[model samples]
Target: MPKAYVFTRYGGPETEAFVDVDRPSPGPGQLLVAVHAAGVNPVDWKQRTGYRRPGESDERVFPVVFGNEVSGVVEDIGDGVEGFAVGDAVFGTALAGGYTEYTLVPAAIAAHKPAELSHTAAATLPVAAATAYDGVRQLDLPSGATLLVTGAGGGVGAAAVQIARAFGLRVVGVASEGKKAFVESLGAEHVASGPGWAERARASAPDAVYDLVGGQVLAEAAELLTDRTKLITAGAPEEEVRRLGGARVARARNAAVLEEVARLVLKGDLDPHLTETFPLDRAGDALRTVEEGHARGKTVIEVTR
Candidate 1:
């Protein structure tokens, strides 16, 4: 039997209960992974708390397994699958069911775990890294362009800072005073502040801005965009992005960009910060970390091994 976290009710993380289940088998084109670690994201908790969109309600329901990113070794390969064999180490997103000892992922979404990253580090990539990559690509900003990222100390913001910098764009990261050092460690010029942060960011760059924070910060940042077309938000305030005539790229696909991100990680160009690790039984504590919105980067649950 394999242990897994299962949510039986829509409430807080406390509502998530750990249970035992038989190991899952891979279906055609699926790979059964012996999960080593699973990344925890805001979406996981949001779903558990019944905060998902109506369209997603059916899929993100109670008794549903939560978790998107997992890093593990392949234990079995279903028929019709090729290019992967037993014992291959890999990481990727499974729309659900990753918070278990075993998970089955479609072959297309799986990638070889970067040689340089541990299972904990690789588990942090799927949702956060993919969101950052897709957001950067959507902007299509030119090299040397000034890009401002909000929530720079958080997972997606941290990833965005590194990705933008790697692409040759100058990055100014906005984070709280406590996280300034962490954000700077990721190669961003850090601006530390609380409310009225946009005004401070304008004082520094006074150029094009990217609103990774969303909500009021997004609304304020949009007003300061040298070119409205240059502003982009990965979260919150979708209407504000539209009102300012800036582009909002939500519905950021997790599976669309993992291959390139994996390549970058493999090449030593991308380093995902896996800041905290919780055991499977402490999954609720992990969700609380994400819910508190103070995580330095990614928080993960070590499922097995």
Candidate 2:
């Protein structure tokens, strides 16, 4: 039996627990991975509170494990799988859950972990990095265009700033005053978040806004652009974005995108910015770091075998 951190039901941290469970077996087109590290995101806590993504099913079994992305070694391959094998290093969005000793990942979305990239770095890519890649590419702004990134201190925003810079675009990054240097280090003109932040951002005269903070922030960002079609958000719902004449990040959930992000990491264009890490037993602390909104960058859960 393997141990996993799970939320017994839809609720608060009270529902989360560490329990012994059978190791997951790979189904058709899935691969069983011995998880080395898992990325922590706000969605993990939101999911525990019963927040479901668009098109996600309402039905869920109790004691569901908590995680979305992972990096590890392949332990077994399922039927109809290709381009992978046992002992191969791999990372992807988890099919079961990532906060465990072993989990299943679909072959279509999984990618090989390059030798130079560590598992911790690879774990952060599948969700945050991939989302940034998709949204930036979706905007399709040309070189020299100014792109404004809200929540630029977090995992996805940091990646977006770097990726935009790599593509020869000018960047304006909005984050808290505390993250001024962090945001500036990523090659963006830093904007301090708070009252009148949007008004301050107006000077950049951004061609597009890549929003990671939704609600009022998304609404405010929308007002900056004359062409609302250039506005996109990963934090807000599609309906909310569309109401503002914008759209949600259209994810191309495939291994090809994963490989591209990995290449960016290797090329020194993007950094996962892993600010903190916790072992599997302290998974609660890891979740709290992100949930409390205090994390400067990405946080990871390292599983010790």
Candidate 3:
């Protein structure tokens, strides 16, 4: 049996409970990982509180595991799985079922963890990294283009800043004044406010723009972009993104982009900013930290030794 966090009812972090369950086995083309750390994301709380996707029915409603990204050593490999063996260290976002002592991951989605990163650091990469990579690619901005990132000190924003810089684009990151230095350290010129942040960004780079904040800032950015410039949002409200004339991205599509992100991390071009970690029993605390929305970077749940 393995310990896992499960929620029987929709509510805040308080509703989550850790319980013992039979260990899961990998099916064909899958690898069983002894989870060491799991990343906590906003989606975890959005789903738990039934806030983001209201009125939508979750097939895995009760007794659900909420984590997405997991980092660990492979304990077993199912028949037909190739290119992986037991004892391989790996990290990836599980489609579901990651906040457990063990998880089964599709071989195609799992990648070797970067040697430079610890399990805790690698655990922070998949979801945010993938979203950042896809957002950068969708924008397709040219070298020396000025890019604007909203929520620029958060997990996705920090990753976007680094990825955009790696692509040769100059970035202006919009964050709170408290986060200004943090954003600047990621290679972005810092603008210290959320609302009308794009306008301030235009002062530095008027030619190209990227809106990571979807509500008013995205709408404001839409006015500044020419047909040659592109606007893309990840981890922002989808309807507001469309209203702002920007494209909204799906998490699965972002997951597909993780392959590139994994390579970048291995090559030392991308870094995941992990700010805090809690044990699996303290998963509720982990969720609360992210819900506060002032975290400097990613928060994660450590599931095992």
Number of the predicted model whose TM-score against the real structure is largest: 2
Backbone clashes in candidate 3 total 0
Residue 64 local lDDT, model 2: 95
Tens digits of per-residue lDDT for model 2, 16-80 = 99999998888999999999999998889999999888779769998899999999999999999
Clash count (model 1, backbone only): 0
Between candidates 2 and 3, the lDDT winner: 2
| Model 3: CA > 4 A from native | 51-58, 194-198, 205-209, 250-259
The Cα error of candidate 1 at residue 29, in Å, is 3.1
Clashing pairs in 3: none
The CA lDDT of each predicted structure is 0.80, 0.95, 0.78
Model 1: residues with Cα > 4 Å off, grouped in runs: 53-61, 206-208, 237-240, 250-256
Give lDDT for model 3.
Answer: 0.78
* Backbone clash count, each prediction separately: 0, 0, 0
Look at candidate 3 and tell me the lDDT of residue 281.
Answer: 83
Tens-digit lDDT track of model 3 for 222-305: 777765336677645666666666666544543346667877877778877778889888887888888888678899888756
- CA shift of 176, model 2, Å: 0.7
Q: Give the C-alpha lDDT of model 2.
A: 0.95
